[model samples]
Each structure stands twice: as C-alpha cells, then as structure tokens.
Target: MNREIMTFDNVGLAYRRSLNPFSEKNWVLKDISFQLYRGEVLGVIGRNGAGKSTLLRLLAGIIAPNQGSISKERGIRSQLLTLNLGFIHKLSGFDNAIMSLVTQGKTIKEAHELVAGVIDFSGIGHLMDHSVSTYSAGERARLGFAIAMQATPDILLLDEMLGVGDKEFKVKSGKALKERVQSDQTAVLVSHSPTTIRKFCERVLWIEEGAVKALGPADTVLDEYEETAPTRGNSPSKTTTATAA
Candidate 1:
C-alpha cells in the first residue's frame, strides 16, 4: 500500500541579490506543488542551474521556501546527498564522521554509536584519521555517503550520485543506493540521465526554469522531456551494471 509522505503547496522560492536588498529577488522555484508518496523514488530532471539543486535543498529542509508551504510527516527525517558532502577540510575523516552525525541532529553519544559503522562502510581503513583535505574527492564522497547511509534517514535526496567515488567504489555505492531506495524508503533524485530515472525512480518530475514541466510516470515524463530538452540529445544516457555486495 502507498501513503503520502510529503506535500508542497503553492511553493515559491527566491534569493535576494547581495547588492540589492530592496531590488527584485531572483526567483528560482515558483508555485511548486507536488505530493511524494512513501516507497516512491522520484526523479527530477532539468538543465544546469535550473533550480534543481535548490529544489533538493528545499525538500531536505536545509532551506525554507520563500513563499507557500512544504509539509512533511511529523518526525520524518530527510538528507540531501551531494557529491561535495560539505566536510570541513581541517577535520580528520574519523572526526568528521561523528560531526556529520551530530549535524544531522543526532546527539553526541548517538554520533559515537554510529561512527564505527560509518568508518567500516567508508572503507577508509587506517587513513580514516587523516585530515579530509589530504583525501581525494572520492574518499570524501565515501565518507559523506557512509555517514548519511548510517543515519538511515526516511528520505534520501540524491544529486546525480553516479559520479560519486572511484571506479571500484562506484559499484559498491551504486548497489547500496539501489538497495536503500528499493526498500520501503522514499528518495528524490536529480539527474541528467533519463536511464537512471527510468531504472530507479517510480515517478518523474520534469522542471524547467525552476517550475515543474511535467509530473507523472517516469516513461511519460521522460518522453516529453527528451523530445523538448534540446540539451538532452536523443542519444541514450548510459549507466553501469553494479552488483550488490
């Protein structure tokens, strides 16, 4: 059975220009309204700088919409999955793991409890104690993903995670991501590739200029998006065949 987990009603978001506080604010997402059902992997597709990431931030509650309303089920947790992951370069990977948990609203003690699993899943091994700046981008992504996965948020927001990690770790992370969404969990993924959306997402939300262009079955939405989105050529986007561990 399916249940509604989140809803957006007449939502509008805009950011004020730094120089002109009194001037017109730059609108990103406007009049956005949608319903997210439990166990549904929703895919959002848009060109670069189309307010897609901003939408994810809105969904994660990392930022509030400037107008309208976004309501989620009480006590439900959400996290946005970005490759950058936003780690402090000065902090050691081990320390950052705990910090990540704490930032997610977990208590210090709870963060400690999850640190071991995060480290293990990250596969950072002895280098876990090294400063995050010393590690490569892939390593940091591993850390970020590991921490978020351990938190086990009810909703996972993904921003084209296909680029995450090294070649080897990609398989592991991809499988892990697949398993999580395949369960009774809800996820909203932003991607340029329709293949990723088709394989993993239950529904598709096509956005243009920060507003929803189409919202329906993945195939139906993607069909129109591909036809209209000149940037997204007719060529099929390719993905990997990663196996679960």
Candidate 2:
C-alpha cells in the first residue's frame, strides 16, 4: 500500500509585527489540513493576501509552521517559486543550472551533466553562455523549469509560472508538464488564471482568509470560486488584487 505523499496537519502560521512586540500575533494561516496522494495534481487558488504563497512555502518546507506540522513521505522536488529562487543574476545560465542542482544536493559532476541537458532542453543553447541577468523574464522561466524538471522529483510545485513563455514555448512546456504528470509525478499549481487551472488541474483547493474555503473536484471548486469571486463589472477595484485578506 502506498502512503500519502504529503500531509498538513492542523497547520497554522502567525507573524509578529516588528513595531509592536507586545501586540497579538497576526495569523496568516490557520487550521489548514490536507493530504496529497501520489500522482495527484492539486491546484491552490485564493484571493490576494489570503496566504496562498505562504501555504506553498510551508509545503515546500521552506518555513516551519507556527502551530502544527507538515509531513512529506519523500522525494519531493520544489521548483522556482519566484524569479530569484535558483539563479544569480550575475551568473551565466549554465552556471545557474549547475548551482541549482548543487543546491538540491547533487554532486558536482552530476550537476554538470544535468546542467548540460537542461540547457539543451531549454532551447537556449547559444544563450547558455550569456549572463542570466541579460535574459528576459520568459527566458529565465524557461531555464528555471528546465533545471527543475531535470531533477525528476516525485512532486512538483509551480506558482504562476506557466504563462512565462511564448505561445510556442507555452505549448511545448504544457505538453511536457502533462507528460510528467502522467508518469506518476504529483503536482501543485498556484495560479490566478481560471483557464490555466482548468487545463491542468484535476483538484482545486480554494483558500480565503488564510484557510481552505473549499476543496473538491477542480471544475466544481472553480465554478464555486468564480461565482463568489469579485468581478470587474460588479467590483472593478477588486480585480486589481489577486486575493483578499
């Protein structure tokens, strides 16, 4: 019997304001709990300041929960949550790839080999020698995804990284991601776009006010979220924000 791949038990996160040490802690997330089984793609969605990114950080073990605990069975590969995650702007793309692999605990030789493949896969063969700082946002995203996919983690966590490339690249990357998910790689995608979520995720976790507001099949949850979500026609100002506190 295969055990669950990841579990969040009564997880909660709170931060103390620097100005007022004696003041009550500002709770960012509370009473969060969920289990992600192997080969499942979970979509995390929420309003602005709802702690969607915070939840992903906790799941990645980047930060410890303030109250409960998060557990992972093993073999989880976390990808670049943001542009600054894996590469240094001054470094070459090839160098950044190697550095990312080394950070993930690969040997120097292994990192070198993996970097070669990743650079090739990125279709930025000529640009590999250039400094990463010179690359555009789309190019950087490609490099990050290539490095992450090369590691072949059992679980992949992506945060609004799908639309970073050109249409052709997006098509190619989408196909690649689909193939990976088909091959027993569980995924967690956090995005504000409904179209993107419907394209890849089978399950959706709608978060609001730092808590899970709803959880179930992707279409169902997305429908409910859309209905409840503030729209431009009804609320123009709300559109500017991704999540609400």
lDDT of 2 by residue, 1-245 (tens): 13588888889999988778798898999989888878877888887778888887887778899899888776665554554455788999888888888877788999988877797768898899899989998888888888877877667778777777788878877888899988877888888898899988887887777877777778887877787655522322222222211
Q: Give the 10-residue window scoring lowest on summed lDDT in candidate 1.
A: 236-245
Best by lDDT, which number?
1
- Across 164-223, the per-residue lDDT of candidate 1 in tens digits comes to 777777777778888987777788989899887898886788777777767787887777
The regions of model 2 sitting more than 4 angstroms off are 74-77, 231-245
User: How close to the true structure is residue 220 of candidate 1, measured as C-alpha lDDT?
Assistant: 75
Q: After superposition, how far is residue 17 of candidate 2 from its true place, in Å?
A: 2.2
Estimated TM-score for each candidate: 0.87, 0.87
121 in model 1: Cα distance from truth in Å?
A: 2.3
